[model samples]
Target: MKEGRRVYGAEDDDPPGPQPGHEYVELVGGALDGQLLDVTSWAGEDREGGAMLITENGLHGPGGRADYEPRPGTPDKWDWQGDYP
Candidate 1:
């Protein structure tokens, strides 16, 4: 396994919580709704700190609830938005 990478527990194992070196992410708009925002420092679980908001304009960081609204009728999918440098 890679360094700082977190592994999810098996079906019979306990759930892994708040992993170190791991940041939770979520997509806000576009075709990739409810997807993981792979863009580093772009978006994350608010509980972790704050989530970045991405739009047709560009990437915004440390955003709050008032930042952007998610699109309706988008299915929650685990899709990769792409990697960040």
Candidate 2:
């Protein structure tokens, strides 16, 4: 086990959350895949926060796809959007 790594209760090989600054890829639906991500801020009081969620395929607003939407986090928060090729 690596330092600061969070382990899932149900599965030993899985994590309950993602680590900061680490890149991860996961199979979503059909042929599209999502990435696990954590963004960092150096000016913060402590290390940056992290999240585990799917990526958005289409741009928001006019003519956007309807099948995929942002995943909600906790009770009041939500993790959404990304820029990649």
Candidate 3:
């Protein structure tokens, strides 16, 4: 999926991704009561930012053992949050 480039505050030409002064929230996928996640990235960052909703969970993707399941109990372990700005 593609999202429109957004700029917050003084950054009128900021690129897509997480920005220090900017904040973004996206609903990944989950049931009404199930866990929901949001992925975000700053304007000057290559890595994406993520957070868990409904539950204090974590984000995981790629780089894992032979078996990998995108679930709460079977997370792959990733550090989406970073210091930028």
Candidate 4:
């Protein structure tokens, strides 16, 4: 992994992103709707645990966190669970 690279959010300016062996998952619903998630170094459990995405306009409003989980049978998508403080 490159320095300063966060393997959570998929939008990056880094060159040759989504490198070989890495995967990008499309998000559904919530504040980060339609955005892709980076799971390059994630294991099966990591993917299952999902991620708490930080956002200013998440389900709980400004400065809240967006909860997203993997969609069953879909290896390239994450469904929004909700958001919280």
Per-model TM-score, in order, reads 0.22, 0.19, 0.18, 0.72
| Highest lDDT scorer | 4
**Candidate 1 vs candidate 4: which has greater lDDT?**
4
**Candidate 3 per-residue C-alpha lDDT over 1-85 given as tens digits, one digit per residue, 9 for 90 to 100:** 2245332222455555444443343332322122122233333232232332222222222221111123344332332221221
List per-prediction Cα lDDT, in the order shown.
0.34, 0.32, 0.29, 0.73
Tens-place lDDT per residue, model 2, 1-85, is 1344332221466555556465332223321333322323322222123232322444443333323223333311223334223
The residue pairs that clash in candidate 3, if any, are 17-41, 17-42, 18-41, 18-42, 18-43, 19-42, 40-49
lDDT of 1 by residue, 1-85 (tens): 1233222221335343324454444444433344343323444353233233333333332221213233334322233333222
Candidate 2 Cα outliers beyond 4 Å, as residue runs = 1-15, 30-85
What lDDT is obtained when candidate 1 is compared to the true structure? 0.34
**How far in Å is the alpha carbon of 25 misplaced in model 2?**
2.2
**What is the RMSD, in Å, between candidate 2 and the native fold over all Cα?**
11.0
Model 3: lDDT equals 0.29
Q: Tally clashing residue pairs in candidate 2.
A: 0
Clash tally for model 4: 0
Q: Model 2 misses residue 17 by how many Å?
A: 1.8
lDDT of 3 at 49: 27
TM-score top scorer: 4
